[model samples]
Target: MSRRRQLHMFDNTTESELHEQTFTDAVPTSQRYLHRRGETYYFKRKIPTDVPHAFGSKGETHWQSLKTNSLQEALRRLPAEIEAFDSKVRKARESRRQGKVPVASRPRTEGTTKYLQEAHIPSIIERFEYSLLQTDMEERRVMEDDAELDIRLADFEQGLKLKKRAAAREEFSHVEDVAQVLLEDERLIAPPGSAARTLLLRELMRADIQTLQKQCDALRGNLFALPPTVPVAPRDLPTMQTAFEAWRQSQDKDRTIDAYGRYVRQFESENRELPMASISLETANKFRDYLHGCDLDRESIINCVGGLATLWDFYERKSNRITSNPFREVQYDGLPRRESSVDRRRFEVSELAILFNSPVYLGQHKLKGQVKESAYWAPLLGPFVGARIEEIAQLRIADILRINGVWCIRIENLEHDQRTKNMGSHRLVPMHKEVIQCGFLSYVAKQKLAGQTHVFPSQRNTNKYRLWSNALTKWFGSYMNRIGLEDPRLVYHSFRFTFKRQCTVCGISDEVRDALTGHWLSRNSSNVYTSDADRQYPFPAVARGIKKLRYDELDLRHLHVADPFDQVDRAWKY
Candidate 1:
């Protein structure tokens, strides 16, 4: 045969024969999803029409470079890639159907009657709302299914003999499958669905309930396809401060709101009266640079940016009020994190002696004008028990109780008037004998006799969020300055470190020390298990540790008064 005639015959080969030749040359026949191009594997699939519109693709086929030269690794990743593509297609189709968008063009116009008429399309916002409602309904159905499963499981656990345990196990596996399919928590592995795994799944679901709801909304809006700069506006939009108020209201405590106020204020001050919708990457960068210009450290800048991002994110994900977050993923470009420059010093033994010997301890100088029992005991207790000034200041009379035959103060968040840092901060701090010897219990009895709930009644609640934290912290700082230990960071918090050091000097175990100091227990299964349990710290161990505490070098013997009732010996006067 002539050479030209042979080439023409090869080009005219049947499609099946051509595919077979390509497969034999590049990929194994067993690997259905993997295709090889130039010795590298690629994920090749036909682009679904609906999915292509969502991604703005006009191509007939999509080829993703797996960036792997190994056939084995490509095979390993094939299933996940296919699953991801399927999910994308599904989401895109749902969005298009809900929005009634034409399959040909993906347009970006505000959802208005005029706009829709001109564009010949459904209102995108209206579509999103409808999609949200539909998703809400679907989520309710899934939640109902999960709830029914929970009820059945609870009945099984409670010894109700209606159904077999095997049925329950089967139901659990089914529910897990449904979750894996719907929720797409591919990272979770619940094989055969043991009780521990069930517990873990339940915890994960609880934590991600809001997030899952937000994802459903985002999918409905086709948010993944939207550009980062595109502003998403809901029908009813709130002002910047109004949005911030809504965000703050959703928080667990008012303290978080108060802490975030500084960032909000900074944004408003730097940028003149800008609306929440007006905030963009440019504005956010300006604010970051402003913070850096003010000589704020990297963490502070991170916190400011992070706080704003969190606020904006809450609105976007929770309320669906906005589309973009300017502060999200913002980087601190050239700013280096300065080592904490605060010159905090632990109270020296001599300094404690000097303070205790001064009128503040000796009852020679009486506390004046809203200065309460905290001034007296907090200073004295600082050297002994090593508690935060605010913790001591906010203590109720009931907190000081005898637990396990030892007098201790319970630092808890039970009272409406108190707040704790974390679970670790809520603990039983054993009251030193020196505290009782200095008429502390006598003062509590007096306050109780007067029908006072707070251990210190003289200090007013200047700020509602923090129970005299600002005022008392300032007072303590001034008192320290007066006594001549005037380091800026050596204010009230230094006592905590001093106490920690003293505990170390006394050879306290780390677990015991953490219990006393309100530090999280060892970062291990023990800590996680303990946190999950009803009781936080091991009480018996904590009690033993507390009993082991002794400030031997600390001598406040002169400060101790003989009579609890004597006017000359009244520590409350100071």
Candidate 2:
């Protein structure tokens, strides 16, 4: 709570034997300090409770922790902290006595400061610039010695001539050759110094007549002495694969990357070991066949071809070397339309009784949390909710919102993240009260997943949906076959069908149910607005769809599926 006094730390015996109790400052100064342990520098601070932050301000963000959960441990560590401070004080004093200054406190670089103050200035047109020193220029010129320097100096002087006022592009009239062009030529004429350069040029022309031979000698020495550096031209044609690679780097999405990677693979057999540019339309068509042969649907085939065509267009834009888009006008069929169907399967009055008493969905597993909730109720909800496997398997504990007075289950996925799927895909379906009673909250709490983690998890998350389709198909199929039923066609998608058909039977309006399950609103009926869009609907109708029906019976004489209490004598005798 109080600042420690500064000690003139010296005499190692007295320092080590004295109290080494370090106290943190209420306000820390940024100046560096050496700590006693390993001579390490550390930032030390103490925050008061009155300071504003979410956590009580006494909770320090600087020190890792006081380490002791108890006050005794805290007092135990304070001395070591003090010892560290004393060591730092001793080191600072020793450094100053040795006549050493920290590198940070050393003098400013004199030559570098002056060089940076002016990099470019005006020369005849008076533009003086900091010449770029080639990183290896000095080493390269080392072998030449003074003779080479003479040759370079002569060339530089010859290149510095003020040409006779003949260049119509008068901005470039001085400086016989363009060396480094910084500013564009368009703005140089109206410059205030241009008039000065013009007057200087006219005088130089008159003087050049007087020393003609020296000018000629200088020009000859430069021209005959040095081999001119020929400007290298870029490669003529952009090879197909090279252009595609440049196209790939330009893509900024995962889908585009996958699309391009597939297109590159499509070139197998043409250049199996290497990607090459397509020469003609026939090559592109042949590649299209290869994609089809791999059993790619029409939409996927179009994706690969369309990706290539776009890549070629990008190539044409970047370099004039490419002439045409090889995949342009290439036609292929698109994906087939999907027909939506409904699952009408549910517990009938008699079948419902059988399910409640059925060995498959009940027994010790049904004794309420005797095992994992999934071991028992996955069958019931698996049949009733009609949800997709991952949607159910990866459900987070928090997605069930207890909003207002109602509990609703929200479903979402990567498709929802990108906003690509239809509105129906992301929704909150009000769960039936039977489920609320059947251990939903208890399961979430048991798994310790109420906040941010998945309600159902595995040792690894990749397996979340792996058992979905095939498992659901077999689970529901065997149930139908196990009982005396003709239907084995039911799968997880049938769950959606079951809910909708049930919603219809309950006489609930189509709009609310569709939104619950994320089905499309009837665009036609939406235009003809109904009272359903009014302030609100009566709650009783909704309760029928979501609450479990209670039987008016006693002594477990009449439990129900649709009727949960059909008494079967010695139900588990089998």
Candidate 3:
């Protein structure tokens, strides 16, 4: 154990009283160099000294000196000096071994705990393993029924392998005998008949494979792992989907299921060949093509795949799952998310004729499949009642009320109000007397009435109401083509538009029309200030307008106008 060496790194300056040192005044101990640097610390420069000496054993060239300092200063410096000296010695010895300096002697403190931990990590691991093996051998010296030693041995191994992030799995191999027994017990704990057993085994196998894979991935991910001269991209990019599930969780659960379905369906149908983890940009483009060609409207595309783009964001934040989200870079574009024109406000003359006729209020034909017979009545009531699908779906037996002995359905704040879209929408609408007994209500008394709630609740699956609008439109289109009455540019929503137009032509006030349509006047101004009573401020005036449209254009005779639908049936009954 030869005496350890030291280097004195100091700068020469014109101090009032100072001496020179053999080596230079080093920036040692505290990780920092003593300099008048920017906004950091107050200066702590040591007073200079003229102490020159070369202290090294034969054939070795090393700088060495001794200095007197306050006890606190020496204590602060000693640790740094020791470390720096060791580093320099190792470097110099390595250089010498390359035929440059001199062969090195090992330091006296080399056998100490700190030195051994830092310098010989492998040897420390090997020794711990040997101790465990010897302990096992000692246990073997006792009888098989030595329970205390067995517990001690199990504890020892458990202590050795406490962390999931493994350290020195090589030494772990020595604990194989106990590990095997513990593993066997774990295997038995998973009942053989249960799916949990297969799941547990698969998980265990996956954990091992993934843990090493993660380590390698992390090694590649260290920013400074590559040389400073190399070019690198910051692993995160715009296209990465991260934490979207957390976002999607905040949405309504039905919407959540719809969103998940959109993605699942896309993967199932188009990207079937691509793994979710390995889905590439080309596949996303293919998906985009598949979506565009589905004949879905622009709004549907936005609804379905907006959820998916959000899904990609969640994918981006994942580390072990997906290092890079391929969907992040994928560009998804579709048609504008607005109805082109609610302006073509015409009622298909034929459909309107049926309401004007109301001839025995006949149910035309039975609807097949997921639809009901009354489903044919939706288009029958749409414009005539000014009912939105959500309002119609939530209709119950109780919400309908008679005012002044006039039979009218009163739509109130229906149950499941959370399902409605727009504000001021849950308000009541006074149904025409004919609409109440339209057979739609008679069907409702069967759904277990609690209050004057949703009127046609059987149709209210939140989705089922609008399902028939398209089929009805197509059927009407073909019927009109056969009948030689040119098809009109109208949709289900056109019902409300026609009702509003007739109200306007009949000179009903804007407020009454809005009230009838369950709309407020000034969304910002009208909602807060105007009450429903105020909305229907002049209903008598509005009823006059309703009468004019009932009589003038529908071209019903005086008796027919009085009870339009019954006219044709009454004539024959007469």
Candidate 4:
């Protein structure tokens, strides 16, 4: 028996497992519902038992050949095929319930009329023109005479005249088959004899007549005869998937692309994947409202809208056809006003005291996979240096160095796959005296002596994004939750806010604080256009600001270790 026949013979359990393996293991997740037979792929799905008769299928499953062997091409064509299948199933179910024929039908709405007139008819005319061009090219390749072309043009004219006459007499029998083929090709299921079908048939007949007239005029030696003027072709409005792929290619950072791509995918899921041109201002507003209704925070909604706006702007600039971005100037009510300072919730001094007195800082906690030296030192460094978690987690032993006779930790994207948030993030931050006194230097020395490349070599950077801090961030969240610090805004990032608050309290200059934290200088600030040498804060001056960062209420005397190598060595063995 054939492999396809054998597949049908398998029991439910085995069939499901095989289906999972075939789709999941052999292809990417986005390409599900695809089944490969020999070399060509087919879109296959099991027909619901209730709707099997509606689909007119004898077997338990139904499938259609994708008609392409190239995986990339198949992927490109898959979305439309999937949409058509879904539309078919939906219409079939509706018809079965109504006890009507299994044909697609919809109440003629204003939006449907607008789409048919502005998008669908123009698309049909363009396709007809392309097919005509293809036939002409084939005839020219065979050296066919103009007499044959003239005869074909005459036949088209006669067909158009007959169609017009039949339509005038309310007899659309001649055009029904042609209209049905066009409707099916566009995946619009107008019932066999419904008024909607009749309207579509009459419109197609009109387009056909106009096109035939143009052809006859061209054949009569008017080589510059203008084709029928329909609305702009729907082909000009690219699919959402196509636009995203183009936009994604223009991006520089993988993380930015991935972050923004997520919002795009979410938008596509919430709103149907529509062509860029079809996304009107109303559509944009509805999408924003939908996101708001989903209980997403205002900031998250802003990001989603902002990301799509950026993408829309990119596509507008690239295409030069999209007149305006729908997502532009979309408003969200009840959004909080922006704050100048870091907006994250800061850890209270008492909370800091509790965290420092925890078992990990007291050296009583057991070392596991994620709860390693990084976890212990990273939190300690956060308040002192104010570096991002990923920046600190990805640190190397070589990053610890003496600059201008002051011990400084360099945060840079120089080696070992280190990545800073941006160019401004690359800077020299003097090690705080508190960090030094807490045996941070001793830990670095031990890592160097042990010939380890990364300070937190035990923390795995195994995520797809290769972020060393992913696992550590999750563990920190759980740790905070366990320690009774269960506020939504109180996160690992809160350390950065606390550090900034301390900088203000310590009377640190804006330039020094910005330099240390790797924040961008304000465009209107005097230091924005300063020379590189003038902008670079001396390590001693930075160290002074760093030393001023003191928590009078929080003491960490117990965390100071005279020798950490032995303790770290013992922990490493675990």
Candidate 5:
């Protein structure tokens, strides 16, 4: 028999009409899984027959109000509801296959004493405070349109003042879901109808009333606000390692993250991984003592303590449980703060003369390292342009280009492998005339012709820290030691001090000096307001200051080469 003849009731309907009717009866694309009842939209889905119903025996359908009347808003909130429904179905099927009842079906007396702890009270209060804040913000958004809200809020406050249980119960009803979420987050089974659950609900209601009272007082034009009480850490407090991972994720620089991670690892190893809450001020002081006993320098100990402080601060902000950092203002007995100039002193004119006249600078040294180009140029660039060792080490050939008729080196984090110290560090520094005279431009041209991406192509960053200057920094330190310039303070960074001192001696303005050194300008400074174009093509004052930067005592005439590529290729050979 033909299919049309075999069909029962719609046999008389044409095939085209049947197809059209099928399409018409289907839900609209925009309203999928949505049902409109009165003015609000509800998320509705039919439970599959294969999956046992978890939402009681009411029907084989799941329904949840989207709590919005507007179609677009309902649609926006539909995805989460759909996922919740699917999760319920999956849980029901799993429970059925296991021949076990769901947790909701368990007796109320089954909950343990763990759920009844007084420590959870503060967490409950914190949750209520957050919810109250959200409600206040939402009410403020609609207060202008609804003129009666303030009066109603005042009335609610009065009801609470009268110790009305019904009003508190009504407020508690709205936060039942929030309470449930808190229980799940704490991994506590506060069985329904249990004393533990009752206590939680009672505290939640009390917290709501307290928050509402504060809101009512604010509406009365009281500007003074008390600081919130710090919440107690829960039984399952996060460890220092946990806090360190979280803080590490928040950091943007790889070098900083690696350095901080090392400090945290050392702390955990020494202290045996104590919980964050357990580490008191005394503990911090002891850790400081431990670091001192490790024979670490005063500066290194301070840095380690600072790293701990940063991690503690991050956890406090994130969890809102810890109020004060134990590591803050830690004292180091018998250790005074080192003087800046004394810590990393600028090189003397005689030291500069010795350094420039060294075998490495004169191309007569037999140093066995691949970072020859970096070792050669980094020190020169540091003293002349005030570029950091890492900055000069990571420079690309493309970074060397003339802008607005001035030779400029662009320090930026635009490339995939490049990184600046910070946002202010990304700038254009005019090439010092002395740097150009020292075969810098000629070397850059040679590298470009050789199709090299980085200026120091031989210097490969193989370390986990991804520091391009790691090899060169080590080599420079050793070289300094070998050349009889072995003062502990006189390292690579001393070149920056040397540069700044020269600028000061030559009467360079603070603005121009900071600009050349990539230092952040003050917010009130006119340089902060300068346009991007002006920044890229620095003003004549900057170029003039670059030109004025002169090392008159140290003669680099013999060090200057007509062609740097024609010199010995020992540094280039890996």
Candidate 6:
């Protein structure tokens, strides 16, 4: 009752209670169907029992709780609820009216049933008897026609069964039962010489035939009731190969096009060139399964399916060749998570010793008498510079030069015989001191002196992709095997791992390493800032970062090879 006590009580009041009090202070009570309980508003309306059956659970009142305590909130909610209720009531009434058949639409049936029983059945029976007695040839012809109709009816019934049309099945079975009952009537089951028996049998048989005819007609109507199909023209739709070519024409990456071509070719080789219309989701899955069966690695399988999906997506939107991308929904069994890190291991000093001490590394192998060509130098260069196998093998003499007083291997796709993986792959990787000490620049100078265009002329481009070092990749595999390095993953490319590992050990910034290796470094903010031309690190600074890397713990000074040009000269008389 005291002022302080009243203020204390007001302080304890909830927001909703305060809101409700403010609303009710203006109006004591709400309109019909709107009521307050606690601090919230509610809408209540009774559904009359006399309403149409579609309304469902009539005579029960419908209630909706308007969550807000404010009067304005309740007012905002009321109109929408009222409109919905009105719509339900209108729909229920409309549905009730639809249930009743219009008198005008009903056919005149006063004499039709009676006429069918008395006259129509007799006429059909007479015709059937006359036709049966005509000839053996005529009987056979009629039987064949009946068999054909029965086959069509069976197909329709089976389709309905597959659709799970239980009501239709029950209705059809009821008609059959009625036909059977008519056939089993006492007049139709009499002994021979009874004219009544013959008449009943013929009449019932005619009725059964008519029943079957009506059922067939109804089923046929239902079967063909689908919306009219747009006729597809015989527009010389492209095969899978042709479609692939069309898609490839739009792609900008030459390597991507070549890789896509491999997948498409392999698909065609196995499945034959499928017309775009015939290439479906099922076929895509089948190809995936086939790839799995062929024992292709997980990455290969993913690439195959992804390539197909990409092509299908291209055609699905750009041209009217395909209805949909069949491979869109295909789930790729992603690369094995644990296998990723384990796939390549950084070369241990011991492993590096084994690799560099091999006959090929010593320049004693068959290729160009180990002219420090791809075979001799690629392995040595990959570990020092972290270049890809192909990149090292396909290097032209022009690619090796001094940048700001430091020798650099300039990676780029400047000729048909050379290609970098991507734009980021074009970079300048400075020569490591160990490589320079081992006479790499000396090898380059010698190749240049001999007027060689490519630094490694022994590695040739025999493929359509202009992958000059593809054969070198296989040779490296064989050499690795010969050296007793049994791991499937520790091929020539593992040298990249060794180089990157040494870089990390030397505390090289990732941006510097990425720049040297031609890896996309945009994901790193520092790399992005560093790459900006105005504030970019100078070429000499980058060269210093490259020079900072060293592997002195394991000595590779024993890998000195004899001149490779001399070996090539002795191999043939040319």
Ranking by TM-score: 4, 5, 1, 6, 3, 2
What is the C-alpha local distance difference test score of candidate 5?
0.70
Candidate 6 per-residue lDDT over residues 1-574, each given as its tens digit: 4434332433333455445533432332223566666667777777744342223332377777889776567767877777787787675555333221011212322112221122233433433333323332243336546566577679646644543443334233333343334434212223333454444444544444544344456434432121143222112235566657779878665678867766776666555444555567888888777665544556667777888778877866677544667777777654342376455676787888888887776657767522336777787887888988878877888887765566688887787656767655777888877787666777777767677888887666666665777777777778788889878778777888888888989888887877777663443446544433223335676787887898877787775445423322232222
- Residue-by-residue lDDT tens digits, candidate 4, 69-113: 655566677788888878887876664333222321223221122
lDDT of 2 by residue, 160-202 (tens): 4534333333444444223113223212222324543444444
Question: How close is every model to the real structure, measured as TM-score?
Answer: 0.53, 0.36, 0.37, 0.65, 0.55, 0.50
Task: Give me the overall lDDT of model 4.
Answer: 0.69
Per-residue error for 526 in candidate 1, Å, reads 6.2
RMSD of 5: 23.0
lDDT of each: 0.60, 0.43, 0.42, 0.69, 0.70, 0.61
The true-versus-predicted C-alpha distance at residue 82 of model 5, in Å, is: 69
Task: Looking at model 6, report the run of 10 residues with the lowest lDDT sum.
Answer: 100-109
Off by over 4 Å in 2: 1-358, 364-372, 382-386, 412-424, 437-454, 457-490, 500-511, 519-574
Put down candidate 5 lDDT per residue, 207-304, tens digits, no spaces. 77777777776666553343375343343456666777778777767778867776766675555445565578988888887665544557777788
Cα error, residue 271 of model 5, in Å, equals 4.4
The best candidate in terms of lDDT: 5
Best by TM-score: 4
Give the higher-TM-score candidate: 4 or 5. 4
Return whichever of 2 and 4 wins on TM-score.
4
Query: Model 3 residue 555 lDDT?
Result: 30
Worst 10 residues of 1 by lDDT: 113-122
Off by over 4 Å in 1: 1-243, 251-255, 271-286, 320-328, 341-343, 462-466, 521-533, 563-574
